[model samples]
Target chain A: MESSRYANPYQTGFLLGLLLVATIYVTGRGLGASGVFKSVVTTTVEAVAPEHAANQPFYQAVVSKHPGASPLKAWLVFEAIGLVIGAFISGLVSHRLTFKTECPPHVPTKVRWIAALFGGACFGIGAMLARGCTSGAALSGMAVLSVGGITTMIAIFGSAYLVAYPFRRLWIGGKQS
Target chain B: MMGPFVPDIITDQLNLIVGFLTGLGFGFLLEQAGFSSSRKLTGLFYGTDFTVLRVFFTAGITAVFGVIILTSLGLLDRNVIYVNPTFLYPAIVGGAIMGVGFVVGGFCPGTAFCGSAIGKIDAMFFVLGGLLGVFLFAEVFPSISDFYRSGAYGDLTLDQWLHINPGLIALGFTVIAVAAFIITARIEKSVNPDAPVYSFPTKSHAAFAVAAIALGVVVSVIPDRQTRLLERATSVAYQQQHPVERIDPQDLALRILDRDNDIQLIDVRPDAKPGDRLPDALTIAVEDMFGKGWEHELAATKKKIFYADDTKPAIEAATLARILGYRNIAVLDGGLSKFKAEVLEVPAPDHPLSFEEQMVYDFRLASAEKIKKLIAEGGKKVVKKRKIKKVQGGCGL
Candidate 1:
C-alpha cells in the first residue's frame, strides 16, 4: 500500500519561495520548463532535415546564433533532466511509483489518455507564444513582480475557470467506466 | 555584499553549478507537495483542494519580500537581477491557450516532468504531445512569428512603470495574497471538509501579514537607483543628460601644481608608458577596472581622475565605469600631452623618431618644447567637440 503523505500547503509554499529566492539570487534567472519542448523539436528537425531546421524562421533567429552549440545544451534542458530524476526519487521513496492513468471514476482510460495528449500539445505550443510556460511566466514572474508574470497568471487561471464550468462532466461525472 | 554573489563573484560556471542545485530543490519540493499526482494538481480547478492557489501565492509573495529585504540590506544589487520582459498580445493569447491545456491535460511543463517520473503513461504522452506542438510551431513560425513578436513592451514592473515604491506595492500584494489565502482556504474547506486542513507550526497568516507590512516599510525607505529599471533607450538618455562630472584642464593643472594630498590620477590607456604618466598615477586598463572590480577600490574616493590617450577612449571608458556604478569619474583634459605642455620641460632630441616607441619619445620630447611656449604664452585653453546624440528594448517573456 502506498502511504500518501504530503507537506502542508503553506509550509511547502514557504520553502518553495525560499528556493525561488536562492534561484534568482544565484542564477539571475528563474526556473523554466517549456523551453525543453522547443529544444527537443529543434533537435528532431535538425536530425531529419538540417537545412529546414536551420532555415525555419524561428531556427534562423535563435538556433543559428549559438553556432556550434548542441540543441540540447540548454540550461532549461539540464534543469529539467534533474527535475525528472528528483521526482522519480521522491515517488520511489514514497511508494507511489505506479504506471496508471489518474482520472475521475466516470472518465474512460481512452478519453483520459487522449485528453492528456491533446492538452499537452496545446500547452507545448502556447508556452512558446507566451515566451514561457506556467513555471517561467506565472510562478517566477510573480516572485519578481514582473508585469508579464502578473498578467500571464491572471489570464491562465481566469481562462481556466471560465471554461471549467462547460467541461464539468469531463472531470466530475456520473459513473465509473 | 552579503550574498547573491552570482555572475559578479562567480562567473565561469553559473548555470551548471546553481542551475542543477536549484532545480533539484524545486523538483524535490514540488514532489513533496504532491504535484507529482495529476489528480492533486487538477484539484485546483475543482474546489476539492486549493493548495495550488495557497502555495503559489505564498511562494510568490515570499520571494518578492525576500528580494526586497535582501536588496534593502545591500546584499543584492537588484539591477543585475533578471526581470522577465513583457510582451502584450502573445502573453495573453498564449496564457489562455495554456489555461485550456491545463484544464484538459491536468499538468503544466514542470509538473509533467514529475508526473512522467512517477511512471504515468499519460504524462509521457503529454511530453510527446508537447514536442509535436513545439515542432509544429517552429514549422509554421514564418507566418506566426509576427504575432508572436508583436506588442513588444520592454521589461516592466508595477513599481517601475507606476513610479510607486516597490515596498508599498509589495504590501498591497500582501493584502491581496492574505485575502486570497484566507478565501481560498475557506473555499476548499466548504467544497471538501475531508480535504486535509493544514495547521502550520507556530506562525499564522496574521503574523505573515504583519511581517509583509514590516518588510514593505523597510523596502520603501531604501533610496531607489534612479532610472535603473528603465528601458535601455531611456536609461541611456538619462545617462546622457547626467554625464559624469568633469574637471577642466586649468583647474586640474592648478590642483596638480599644489599636489593635493587626496588627488589620485589613474591612467586607463591601453598603450600608456612610463614617460607618458604623471607622478604617483596608477595604471589600470579600462577592462581590468570594471571586470576585476578594481573600480571598487575607488568606492570611498571623493574624486577619481582618469585619462586615456584620446578624448574618445576617455569618454567611452568613463561612461562604462559610470554605468557600472562608479562615481566622480573626471577625465584628465587632453591626457599626458596636455600635462607635459602645461607643467613639464622639453629635452633636446639627437635622432629622428618614427617607430611607435619613437613617436611616443618624440611626443614627450615635443611636450617640453610646448611647455616653454605655454610659459611664454601664459594661459590655458579648453577643447570642445560637436555632439551627435541618439537612442533601444529586449525580453524573454
Candidate 2:
C-alpha cells in the first residue's frame, strides 16, 4: 500500500523561514540542535555518573553552573524538546508516525538501530569537542558569513563526502540499484 | 548586544515559561519538516534528499534580510543586539570536530533533542554522549585552558573587524544565498529532471527574483561603518575636546565653613523622609531646586552654593551645575549607601537615585552575577549572560 504521508517541501521551508525569523527576533540568536544535545548528555552523565562527568572538561562547564537546575532546562534543550513535539505532531497529523525502522535494503532493523546509536554517540562526543553542530555551524555560520563558520561547513561537508564512500553499503545498497 | 527587545523584568520562573513556549514552536517546526529521521538528516551527504539544505538556507536568508530591513527603517538598533565572537582557533577546531559528529550521529544537538522528544531511542544515546563530551572538555580544560582564553578579543562584530558597514556584509551574504539556491536548483534538475514538484506560493518566479535583487541592493547601502577602533578613537577625541573641569570637594567644604555668605545648601532628596539627609548636608528635591529657578537664586552671587546627593546625584548636579554654572559641583563617591555603610551611625535604607548611580549599580550587579556564575562553572560555559540593572525614575530614565 502507498504511504499516506507527504508534505509540501516548499511550505515546510517557508514555515521554517518564519520560525527562524521568530527565533532571531526573540533570542537575538539562531536555532541550534547540537549544542542542546550536548547539554543533555552533560546533565545526565553528571547525574548518573557524577565522577566521570566531573572529570571531563565538557561536563564540568554546564553542570557546574546549573548544579541546581536540570541540564534539560537549557534554552536549546527546550527548543529541541519543542522540535520533537512539533515534528511528532506533524507526523500524527499526517499519519506518518510509524515505529518501523529505516535501513539499507539488506540491513536488519536491529543493525540499523545499533549503527544509529554508535554514530549518535560519536556525534555527541564530536559536537562537544567542537562548539556547535550543523544547524549552529553550517546554517548559522553561513548566515553571518563568519570565516570560521564557512570553513567549518566546508570541513564538515567535505569530511562527510570523503567518508560517505565507505558508509554507502550501510546507508544504500553497495553496487546495487 | 544582539537581542531581547523586551527586558526580563519578570523573575526566572517566568523566563523558563517563555523558553518552554518558544521551544514548543521550535520543536513543532522541526517535526513537521521531517528532521526526526536520521536518514533524512544524512541525506544532505547523499544525493537523494536536499530538504535540509533548502529549509536551512531559506530560514537564514529570511532572518538576515529581516534584520537588515528592520534596522534600515529605524525600528531596531543593530548595536543593541549580540553577535557571536569569533575565536579563531577554538571556533575552527570545535567546528571541525562537530562536522565529524554530524555524519556519525546523523543528528546535531537540536535535531537530537527533537528526535529524542519524538521517542527516538538512539537520539537519547547521542544526547548522553554529548554530555560526556562536555564533561571531558571541562576536566581537560586546565591542559588547554591557555588556548581557550588566549584569544581574548572582547565582543568583536563583523562590522567592526571588517571595517565595513554591516548592511554591506549582509548584502553580500544575500547575493551568495540566492546564487547558491539557483545553482542547487539547476543541479537538482540535471540530476533528476522530473524531480517532485514543490514550488513556492509566488505568482511568478520573476517577482521573487526581483524582490531578492531589491533586498540585496538595499542591504549594501547602510551609512556608518561601525568599528571598535573607530569608536575608541571617537571617545578619546571627545574626552580631549571636553576636558572634565574638576572641582575639588575640599575647596567647596572650606567655602561652606565661611558661613558669612547666604548660601542655600539644597538637599536634592527632599522626598527623603526623616533621617534621610547625610550628616551636616542639605537636601532638596530637583523640583524645588528648579522651582524658583536655582538659576535665578544663584545668579551673579558671590555666596557659595553646595549640592550633595548620592553617587548618582552628580549627574543631576551637573545639569544644575550647567544651569547655575555653579562654581563648584561635588558628588559623594559612596553615595548614601556607602556613607551609611562606612561613616554614618544610622544609614539611610532608601538608596539615592541618580542616572549615573543607577548605571553603576547595574554595571556592578551584572558583572558580579556573571563573575559568580563563571566561577561556579569553573570556566567551561560557552555563552555568557550580561544583565545590567539601572535605577530609573524620571521619564528619561
- Cα deviation of B335 in candidate 1 (Å)? 15
- Model 2: per-residue Cα lDDT over B257-303, one tens digit each: 44335444444554543344422334444533322223334343543
Q: Which ten residues in a row have the lowest lDDT in candidate 2 chain B?
A: B388-397
Stretch of 10 with least lDDT, candidate 2 chain A: A1-10
**lDDT for residue B75 in candidate 1, whole number 0-100:** 57
Which candidate leads the pack in DockQ?
Answer: 1
- Give model 2's docking category: acceptable
Model 1 CAPRI rating: medium
**Per-residue lDDT for A70-134 in model 2, tens only?**
76666665666566677677666656555545555686666666566656555544444434566
Off by over 4 Å in 2: A1-11, A49-57, A141-151, A175-177, B1-3, B74-80, B116-154, B192-194, B197-206, B224-397
Relative to the unseen true structure, what is the C-alpha lDDT of residue B187 in candidate 1, on a scale of 0 to 100? 82
Q: What lDDT score goes with residue B96 in model 1?
A: 94
